[model samples]
Target: MKLTKIALLLSAATLLPNLASAGTLEQVVKKGALNCGVSTGIPGFSATDSKGAWEGLDVDFCRSVAAAVFADADAVKFIPLTAKERFTALQSGEIDVLARSSTWTSSRDTSLGLNFTGVNYYDGQGFLVNKKLGVSSAKELNGATFCIQAGTTTELNLTDYFKANGMEYKAVTYDTSGQTIDGFKKGRCDAVTSDASQLYGLKLKMDDPNSVMVLPEIISKEPLGPVVRQGDDDWFNIVRWTLYASLEAEELGVTQANVDMQLKSENPSIKRLLGTTGTAGKDLGLKADWAYNIIKKVGNYSESFDKHVGKDSPLGIDRGLNKLWTQGGLMYSMPIR
Candidate 1:
């Protein structure tokens, strides 16, 4: 059932009568499933499969977290959410963690009563228009109507970009990304604007995917990541390290196919990451092999990227800023030791 925004907000508020008392991990453990909020339908990030199973990069992140906690990747209940309702759902404890492809912004971080663990994808806002539009640059999109999802940074970014360029346009807002793309396809707007990565995913839904062209001009920075409520440090650490474990596993040459072989390695970093020589997992209030379960079940960052949005997938997005720090990218993990 589709709940109205007001109803959803009130429902979320009811879940948390006491904001000060937080125990997300305990609640999740008692329930035996991690409640993960994800996008309603973003093909490469979070969408349902032919069998009605949620599968995508963000979905994999949720699975990884579940694996870390319960040693079972499937122990997660995927709650599909719209952009407008994601934060409130997280705030009200409607979901244990939000693996939605939400950007990490200062206002959201400081004002939303939530904590972003780390960036899962580094992206930039861009426009998607029909190839017939013949518009090559975002600057040339003056006076063009745009289809944008409401309650997203994309709307504000679009407004700011146009204002800075002294251009004016009409915004056709939708509650979900799929609806925004549908609005664009149905000619409600001349263009659709979102993170460039999402534009690729959206194009997959087009009648003729090749008809859509993502303009070259990237308008704004969008560091997308997972989020959890702020009060519980333990849950925060678990979520944060779960992401870091994926990245670190990639850097340490740990893939799902080879994790078992890696367990016997002598490298201190690998040993610590696999819980063969450290207490990092226990320190985070998780089992000693928390990272091991994540790597074993969900693979590493590179694996998940390749399987969901990289060259192996339809999106074909390059690692760019999502690559490891050692590989000249921004994905640096904190020390597990």
Candidate 2:
């Protein structure tokens, strides 16, 4: 009887991989479009223009994945979601992946039944205050009122920071950033706090960005990235490595202008990446030239960063921690082979 029970467990384990892969990719193909979850409106991250067309870093991420699958970046339907609604949308299969800016945390990973692919942005919590407030540092803001969002890590982190610093603060909570910023503008709070990247984006909408300055201190690490439901490993791999493809393309000297040229190169890694030399794509249940589609359509990590988040954009953040590892940053991809 013990042997029978052990045999049943072993057989179930062996069938798991086959069961998971049996129709996931096929289902996506038959659907004709990838449904992507993204932030409602955050400039440079994800936002809808006047025409209601979605665009930004997160939008590009979804497009990149669509490019890999259908060879057409436009083959995607964007489902805009707020922070609280993102996970539910993904779990309900309303979206294939949540490309919204979400911090990767142990609790979110384990308890939430979500899989974070990898970090796209290395951000941190920070404070943005009017320069006239005469505050040079966050530590100086004792007993200050702050404009913050409710039901977010920003709120919890705000509480913990004040508690740890022995500071007193009044939190003027709001559900949306528009309301939070309006409250700050109306003098309801001395300071406004959120992710540092968000501070930059938010400040761009202010009457004068020079009037509001971000504090030098960045508290708490925020490794933000895309996420998906936990059960589908193949779907997870496709999304995760679609992000990695951008980074890898930049590292390998492939760009939108030169991906076609590089695809003909004789280098082993580059060839495997371009689908000329290996089964890398087939292993992921995608076309051999999956990376090529992303590179040709969406460009690479550097291109995406420069176009949306780098110095040329209003946010104008230096890619200090986001640069490729060889350039002394943390953007690294696992081996494609």
Candidate 3:
């Protein structure tokens, strides 16, 4: 009897970590809202509007996750974080998931105890400068000073690019993207370097948007996406598949305006995606119409892109690498089944 009791206790102890790892989804359901980590303010990505409501590509991704879990797109608390504070917030459980425009690098993936679910935006580093500087290309700025955001891959890339070109430069660092751009506008640096998409967004904030232009050189690859804490595979899958569902919806020609109509789709792929003919929802511990809720409320990935940062939006960014795979771009979804 003593031996049996000891064995039982040992087995239960081994299962404790697993139970803790699986609690994120359950805690979210009980809390009635997901705490999402986002940037302080990067327009077209995760910034607030005139009405003080959060809306952007990253914000929309957070809403989609809320829709999948609670059937309510607005059931989320957006916590703005800086680059240095983002990882700490996620590690401390202050936020459930991070949807900020953060890059997926090997050090962050391995040493930080985090896992990047998937890439939502494929980006590269570039330079933005005032056209009056008489420099049309990055190679012309041999000894320029750059305003860059601190605690980001941007600083390292800037150093590497200049070193490789046998040139030299100085860096003026800021805590947020907003401040980085402000430093540029104030002439604190000769140029600003960041992700190309971000330079576009920052350009819009200028008093005369056309005064600045992104340079032709792209120095580094930045695959930005959502991130979840390590050891929580269940929550990871929910977030990962939430992004995939949006992509798959686009592939199947489904949109927020037509998700209901697509439910009647006879195609097996559409059927499984809409939760009408598969165990996808059951496997995720969500309702049968979970994905349907995501599409109907949040919309497909392409829809969010167009509305926030693409051609339909103010940024007017052309869909280069972000185009769907069928169109020769890199946006591809995994099998829903």
The numbered model that scores best in lDDT is 3
Tell me the deviation in Å of residue 55 in model 3: 0.6
Using lDDT as the measure, what is the rank order of every candidate, best first?
A: 3, 1, 2
Q: Considering TM-score, where higher is better, how would the candidates rank from best to worst?
A: 3, 1, 2
**lDDT agreement of model 1 with the native:** 0.92
**Best-performing candidate as measured by TM-score:** 3
* Candidate 1: clashing pairs of residues: none
lDDT of 3 by residue, 1-337 (tens): 9999999999998666445556799889889999999999998999999999999999999999999999999999999999999999998789999999999999999887789999999999999999999999999999899999999999899888999999999999999999999999899999999999999999999999999899999999999999998878889999999999999999999999989888889999999999999999999988889899999999999999999999889998888999999999999999989
Candidate 2: regions farther than 4 A off: 1-24
RMSD of 1: 6.4
| Clashing residue pairs, backbone N/CA/C < 3 A, model 2 | none
Off by over 4 Å in 1: 1-21
Residue 109 accuracy (lDDT) in model 2: 91
lDDT of 2 by residue, 1-337 (tens): 9999999999998666446444555677899998899886778889887898888888899999999999999999999887778888877677888998898989999876678999998989999999999989999999999998765689888888989999989989887777788899899999999989888888987888789999998888889999987767888899999998899989999999999888779989899888998898999989898999999999998888888888777778999999999999999999788
lDDT of 1 by residue, 1-337 (tens): 4568889989788556335537778899999999999999998899998999998999999999999999999999999999999999988789999999999999999887889999999999998999899889888888999998999999889889999999999988899988898888899999999999999999989999988889998999999999998878888989999999999999999999999999999999999999999899889888999999998999999999998999899889888888899989999888889
lDDT (Cα, 0-100) at 26 in candidate 3:
88
**Could you tell me how far off, in angstroms, the CA of residue 180 lies in candidate 3 after the best superposition?**
0.9
- TM-score, structure 1 vs. true: 0.94
